[model samples]
Target: MTGLLRAEWTKFRTVRGWVLGMVLAALIIVLLGVFTAANNYSSCEGPDGDDCPAVPLGPDGSAVNDRFSFAHQVLDGDGEVTVRVASLTGTITYPPPDHDKIVPGVVPWAKAGIMIKESVRQGSAYAAMMVTGGHGTRLQHNFDGDAAGSPGASWLRLTRAGDTITGAESADGVRWTTVGTVRLAGLPPIVRVGLFAASPCDLTVTQGDLGGTIGKCRLARAVAAFDHVSLAGNPWTHDDVGAMRGAPALSQGAFRESGDTFTVSGSGDIGPYGLEGGQPVERTLSGAYTGLIVVIVVAVMFITAEYRRGMIRTTLLASPRRGRVLVAKALVLGAVTFVTALIAALVAVPLCRRILRGNGNYLLPVSTATELRVVLGTAALLAVAAVLALAVGALFRRSAAAVITAITVIVLPHVLATASVLPVELSQWLLRLTPAAGFAIQQSVPEYPQVTGHYVPQMGYYPLPPWGGFGVLCGYAALALGLAVVQLRRRDA
Candidate 1:
């Protein structure tokens, strides 16, 4: 087994053309991923009142939406804060297409309520208890923890004990129901605790009968009135002394406090935006994933090239066990491609962000762990696809035939599903059942029911869980490898 594996690896590395093809695959991943992200710049609005015009976002920008607004006060040390939210309301404003400018519609994941943040800075560590315009009550902490559908309690509280914060909700502020708990490590002695509002304006455009989501968007404002105001910390002095009393920014929007009543309103995003950069940052390989075409090519050639050059006979003679020989080849291909693709994915993610920032645009918020998964998982994704391609190539044993079949069977389905070329349902099934399911590995933002967006593949949303999708891809590769082994034993070398 070891000898057979060594022989296959030697043959693969010794051929300069094959080595160059592998290098080309990595270069393609980086160049395509980074340059595509660099060219796309996304600017979001908070208090500025700016928004994305109803224009097409080309290929890279359509699936991204990350904007929100927040208003908070800094409090020193650990203490409890509770507030009764009288109402949570929002309105979606269409920009002049229809005569009716403001529509009574709440975007999915429109959140308004109380929160405790390590800082007011975007992407800082925080925990929130919010009432969605539609999805009921939720207790979300940081970028990943979400405890949604907690009985629609209007009065929310965040009690901190050292690094741990417990989120509780109540109907009357008397009976508190524990919703969730989270630990914010290195929480500064002083932290921001107050009200916030945000909405992800998913722009759904209806062209005649077909309603296709053109942009993951936001063009709305969420307003909430909080009374029964209570605090256990120092009174947060809001600065803006010379800005006048009736500033529209303060009167109609932002935060206004009078006695025990506080009205908070904002427009922008709060939660961590889904995987990839919200609007500005394109992470999931964007054009770089097209480089998988090169990866597939190299993968198919891994075996077909041997068959084309009549080297199969020598390979079989060197390793008499046909099944063992196939396994060795698969192992070699999977390992090498895994390393190459991993390097490409890691390089592409950070580089893409740098380029996007260079253009004065910022990526949506995502956790450090999620970032790691995207980079590492993309590599795993490519490795799995490459192995699957190799197995399919072995089954066909013809370079052209294998390459064409692999593309038709694997690559096309992903492109059609991910690019919105097919119906969302059909695309989801294709991803669920096909090797292209491997792409789920790179998804950093998980689909939350509370958050509304196109959870379909075209918008980079995967129906299957990341590991689950990857598992399905692996299953197909395993099945293909099994069939290839059987064929190698029966068919002439």
Candidate 2:
């Protein structure tokens, strides 16, 4: 295997043209990363208040997402509650382009349903079966798991049987599917259990708005109309946790009753804060993915060129085990791309910080550790993409076709997702399923339920966690490599 690898390396390095292609990939990443970071500028000013709207930054200085809306009534003892959500619609009031009026836009992840909370303190353990604006039905619990379910389920039922609380969603009200169960330990008899709605979006600051020079991250609110709500065993009572109407943090949220049904409109934040102001969306390493195009093109050409120039026979002759030849080539391609991309990203990220701060643009808070992750993740993403393209090139053995396939399959999805070319649902799926998921590795800021802006693709926030998203791309590479090896073993080079 070592001999086979050495032979592949010798063939690759001896070619000056291919060497230059690798050089170009590195230069592209560095150049674009720097240029985009420098050019993308922003600024922010006020939101005058004591608990003034702040970018949720942790001890590490990266964004600490916190925001959501909760409308509920306190239940003093353990019991079960069941409700049918007729429909869930989410709303965000954006600062108008002219700053004269409030513009309303539908929010993604806008949720309406029944919840049982340990407290209204935001971060307390909770569970719910909900119907979202764009994500369909979900059985979300805790802080991170936004668990998915079959579409169009209308009934949300939560029952506290002893210490374990179980949530279920039913298509017909009679037949139910268990979303999950959670034991909110230290079992308090009383809990805040009722309807809730939340949305996170950016309140756009106009060109000369006084309240904000750039943005004041505003929380989103979801609304649900229920045909019926029954707390099977007890009487429900209103509990504000002591915040008066129009409180600074609560922001004018209220609940009302209309006949047997109830309507709740509340504003506050729950979960991670999606807050950043005056910070340019294009932070360091913006537009870095454009360089992956060149990396993939070069990587595809690496193998396709071998076949085109009739060098595959010579490659196989040196290593009679044809599968070994493919593995060696993939390792060589992935390693070279990783090094080149790493150097490029390291140089570009620092330059971006310098230029952005020089322009007086406030960047989203980032820790030193987060910075390292972003830089390394970019290189890893590029390395994986290069390997994917190389594998595809092996399968097809056609330079033009493989290059086209690589760009179309891997590159275009990222572009469409970033641009938010389609509906949010479709855009998210594109990133989740495609090789473009690799871009999540470079997501510097996280999506906070407390803040909403243009939650589209180009903002650099992703629906998947960094490594989780990158894993999708890696999966593609692994599958393609496996297939390419099989083909190499069976077919003539």
Candidate 3:
């Protein structure tokens, strides 16, 4: 083990470029931290009538109705922007007494989108859904960014099949991901959705000119394109309620009512929903996961680069033992990932907490376990990548091709699993087993009902549970190491 470590150390130290690579990675991580801090601090709002517009976001900016309360304002073209919603103090009544009998109640939904065309100018928009008195719930979809084709490309969809409400997203007008789901309260008597928008600040403008700026944004002009806008599920009416009332008990279970509570129940429960009810910072933490992903990629490339140079043979010849070499490579790779992940989380956590604090109810200080999982799990992910790359590099002894193939095999499975929307049984199996699917741990929310996707032995079917998924990744590493060992013993240096 000592010889193996020393040899691995010698190989890493002998390469000036590799030493510099670690430094460069650290520098990039520090730059990101600086950027996060600068962005958050400059966008801070004051106690009274701050420059930042405060409004709750919906799918798009929709007008509020009797059952819901909403307000919105556009900031400058670009800056830190946020919107929020709070249940207002009134209850609206619907005419249909048995609206519960129809599809139960109205499913209120909302959308928010912003437009950033030119460098200096930008605008924010929102939309909401409100139903006359009937038992229904809100299916709020957040489309806050200015990306996508906008008007059409960036919108939310809420559809109901039987008693289930499915929320989906569309990049173009075609494909979609079932982003989320919710069950409405028992035959809701009424439902309402809210809309909001916070435009970005004009970074080019002087501070003195900021207070005088106000823009006339028309909803009608922006809303005209919504002709294609439609709602699925049961759009119950007053007449249909009589037939639905006192109907046979719901096949799933009874809906419990409370004062605007968010709970998961029924057979269709998809584990837990990640509520965006916190301050701006928490949302930022959730979104910046892409950064961690980038670091993982870099780590993989670092180890694989050696194989391209045919330096790995020298590495193996010095160490002789494959397992120890793999372990040392993993330790270095994990160190790189762990440091990057910690820095990202540390900077993101505080900034996110500050933005989300007080204004919109957000989970602040972040959970210790969650933070540990993010940073340590990220290290583990990179470690696995390093193992796979080392194994591949050892076997192929060619860096570039091995790295490319490793990425294709490891990352492609997740994309395919996500895109496959049919063969419910097959999809379930793929979701748990796919390499990318394992990364879904970052989501912290299960995609479907726990029971719906569970493994079935009789039908010759199996799916990885969360921990089991980790095992699969380990198994891959083990198999690669095993093969590398065989190759090491068989091949001549």
Best-performing candidate as measured by lDDT = 1
The digit string of per-residue lDDT tens for model 3 on 400-449 reads 66666666656655444434333445555555655544443343322322
Every model's TM-score: 0.77, 0.61, 0.44
The TM-score, computed over Cα atoms with residue i paired to residue i, of candidate 3 is 0.44
Q: How many clashes in each candidate?
A: 8, 20, 47
TM-score of 1: 0.77
Q: Model 1: runs farther than 4 Å from truth?
A: 14-16, 30-82, 105-108, 117-126, 160-163, 186-212, 216-218, 231-263, 275-290, 305-311, 339-357, 361-376
User: How many residue-pair clashes does candidate 3 contain?
Assistant: 47
In Å, residue 464's CA in model 1 sits off its true spot by 2.8
Query: Relative to the unseen true structure, what is the C-alpha lDDT of residue 51 in candidate 1, on a scale of 0 to 100?
Result: 49
Best by TM-score: 1
Q: What is the lDDT of candidate 3?
A: 0.38
Backbone clash pairs for candidate 1 read: 67-268, 67-269, 68-268, 68-269, 69-268, 201-217, 201-218, 275-445
- Candidate 2, position 488, lDDT: 88
**Which ten contiguous residues of candidate 1 have the minimum total lDDT?**
55-64
Model 1 lDDT tens row, 356-397? 767656455555666677777777877888888899899988
